[model samples]
Target: MNIKKNEKPQEEQLRKIYTPLWQNIFRGATENQDVDILNILKKVPIFSQLTKKELIKVSYIIYERKYATGEFLFKEGNPGSAVFIIKNGTVSIEKSNKLNIKDVYATLISGDFTGEISLIEDSERNANARCTTNTTVIIIFRHDLFDLIAREPLLGNKILKDLAAMVTKRLKEANEELVKYKLLAEVKNDH
Candidate 1:
């Protein structure tokens, strides 16, 4: 169809009117305030000491992932390579006995974190992490963390120190539990 020099085609007019409105709606949906990565990072112990600028840098290297209820985030004996900070929902840290019966070791909720062992070493997971509800997590892969450290040594040092402290604390707690269990076993054996 031929159009007058002063009049736009019907399709062209519709495109001009709808494009900006669609763009705004799309942007709003994708950039919701609840997905603020820096704020989420601040709640995590390893990232608590970071400055806003540093957190922003760290945020660029990390990403968000979601899991459905009953989904396993990682299984015991799987190669672990990333740390996950719970942004929303609950996860169960479970261990399987010799008979393959799973026992829940801990229930982690939003603002809690897990998979920290993967940050320090390349090893198999010691327990399984399964989503108890629809869950969202901030994941930081080992390679990304190393890259961040290489680029920002000061921030990296702080994170490494914090991670070490967390690991030490967890080790102490685990040791205490082991001693308690051993004592219980000894008492039962004597009976």
Candidate 2:
């Protein structure tokens, strides 16, 4: 007896994964009116230079979410799926110890984006984000973004460059803060 190859199972599995994601994205978008909020992102330093058309494309892939104060947006080591733009309130980025989150490393306020580092590199989240107040955020998923890049290389390159520059600037500021803290510690020790 001859055995035949089965492609149906693989196709069904893919459809199962993609279908719900597409539906969720569409539902989130329709409910949240993300386009209106995304308009404000153009004023953000990293994305301010993006043209109107570019912004529109980016807007479509973004969805708005609201979190109650003290709610965790993500935890360190969790898989990064999307980058977030803070629309309202603040999010505290904290480092996780073995069993608890501690050391408030950064507070991202309105007009700031977090998790972009993971989008480009497909890495685990480096820190935890918790809502410091009732917060609103706009999220753009990495897979949706990658698809856009495949179709539009120029716009994608511009976004990637801007993201890299933003990360570099943040890193520099963080290094300076570390140096300042180290100096303060040494001064205190001498007393």
Candidate 3:
């Protein structure tokens, strides 16, 4: 491949890598336009960066499972394998405290998601996810996601970038909360 004198190879490579995913929509992509799964995925932040064409590809690797109320999606010590996106229903993100009391840390409703860590690493789940109501969730297993990446690196890059951003934002929020609580405790001690 001959590089034009005016263009740097690195710049050309980046342009290919960063080609807009939304171009398909402007070009009248009619396929998968009406699919319910595509509509559901469009709202998810992880997949929000994808074009309809890329989303149609994602729809291929997802599994929809319905869980009964009180059923656990995954336990705290279990090896994480999938990211769960709630289609419709309530999910409780629970953690057991040092006193062995079960605490519901977060309640996620329709269109919300969790378990993103599983996609980026072979880590154990830090908390348990239980359905507070009969729930339908879209599960994207790591194996399937990796397979997608192997087939379409661009789509995979977009997803991984989104995952990293989500994790970073959450970690920052957690750190800020910890600082606030520590300050509160120190003030109480001073009094």
Candidate 4:
């Protein structure tokens, strides 16, 4: 890069203006400390209903983590303790078949979320979540959720309601798929 005698470097210009005053307040907050969490959370359906203030409160309890390609986010039958929202890259949900082969149930992309059951209950995970590509995920642990609920009951209620709605919607879709598959099988049998 060539610069004239009177010209300031781009980095120097950015350093002077891009640093916000609030960044100083949150210094040393967390390993992946960044300001984009609220924007990310707003895109997730389960958190879409929350107001800006509620989302800001929730952001404090969330943490961001990265996974390399081929890393397992969580294995099936493992005890669940946190919910994950995909921030970047892809994740594959897989289950073991009778032949012991892993069959991919779904490929989730950015803006998709999983592990919600862990947030609401103590059941084991039902599927294996593996990173298909280098991925970034935002995690909300059960303990943090509990703390949020204790501090803000109304926000907690809204979150729970939204979560329930998402689960119900998924169940309905699964039921519809089952019906279609059953109808196809019956047709095949008739022929």
Best by TM-score: 3
Report residue 152 deviation for candidate 3 (angstroms): 1.1
Q: Model 1 over residues 1-191: C-alpha lDDT tens digits? A: 35567755544443444344322211211212365667668877888799999999998988889999999889999999998877777788878868787756667766667777788889999989999999998888999999999899999999988888877765675566567657756876899
Clashes of each: 0, 0, 0, 0
Candidate 4 per-residue lDDT over residues 50-84, each given as its tens digit? 99999999989998899999998899999999988
lDDT, candidate 3, 96-166, per-residue tens:
87878775666776666788778889999998999999988889999998899889999989988887886
The digit string of per-residue lDDT tens for model 2 on 65-178 reads 899999988888899988887777778877765656365656766666678766878799987899999989888888998898788888888877877786676667556656
Residue 10 of model 3: what lDDT? 52
Candidate 2 residue 39 Cα shift, in angstroms, is 3.9
Model 4: worst 10 consecutive residues (lDDT sum): 21-30
Task: TM-score each candidate.
Answer: 0.74, 0.67, 0.76, 0.75
Q: What do the candidate models score in CA lDDT, each in turn?
A: 0.75, 0.70, 0.76, 0.75
- Global local distance difference test of model 2: 0.70
Which candidate, 3 or 4, would have the higher TM-score against the true structure? 3
Q: Is candidate 2 or candidate 4 better by lDDT?
A: 4
